[model samples]
Target: MDMMVSSLQQQRAITDQLRREAGIKRIPVSQAVEDIIKYITEHEQEDCLLVGFSSQKVNPFREKSSCAVL
Candidate 1:
């Protein structure tokens, strides 16, 4: 268990370094959820416009995979 935790910490350090080098933004999940909820509430989707969503079976954490909410 100690080895696993240490390995995870090392991996996290590498990930943080890579993200810093790439200039990526990391949004807190709570903040993102709050923003999404606020947007939906303020927009009040009463117009009943075309709402579309699609997703594929893939590891969302993969750098090559993507998702959009619009």
Candidate 2:
């Protein structure tokens, strides 16, 4: 459990670093919604309703911090 937590933290740090280096700004709610729409359209056979729900529930606040990655 300890190792897992530590690994997760490291991954989060790497992700944050990449995000910063690539100049990828935080994803806006509108953009996320649009991306979900595109994804659903491209994968028509998939369950889009569930994907939409999950996408909407993605909390930007939770993603802003770097604690760790698994």
Candidate 3:
């Protein structure tokens, strides 16, 4: 268990370093969810369009690999 925790910590450190080097901004999940909910509520009475992004080709027949809201 200690080894696993250490490994996880090391991986997290590496990830954080890479993100910093790449100039990537991380968004808190709660804030993202709130933004989505607010947008939906504000546009509930009218048509709202959403665009999806994926790194790989998507097939309609297969279930999405990630959460639809993500």
Pick by TM-score: which candidate is best? 3
Summarize candidate 1's per-residue lDDT along 1-70 as a digit string, tens digits. 9999999999999999998988976789999999999988877654233332233333343466377778
Candidate 2 per-residue lDDT over residues 1-70, each given as its tens digit:
9999999999999999988989966789999999999997888756555444356456343445566688
Q: Over 4 Å off in model 2, which ranges? A: 24-70
Query: Ranking by TM-score, best first?
Result: 3, 1, 2
> What C-alpha lDDT do the candidate models reach, one value each?
0.73, 0.77, 0.75
The candidate that wins on lDDT is 2
Misplaced by over 4 Å in model 1 are 1-21, 45-70
Ten-residue segment with the worst summed lDDT in candidate 2? 53-62
> TM-score of the candidate numbered 2?
0.33
lDDT of 3 by residue, 19-60 (tens): 888897779999999999999888866542344334235534
Query: Each prediction's TM-score against the native?
Result: 0.35, 0.33, 0.36
Candidate 1 clashing pairs? none
| Least accurate 10 contiguous residues by lDDT in model 3 | 47-56
lDDT of model 3 at position 46: 59
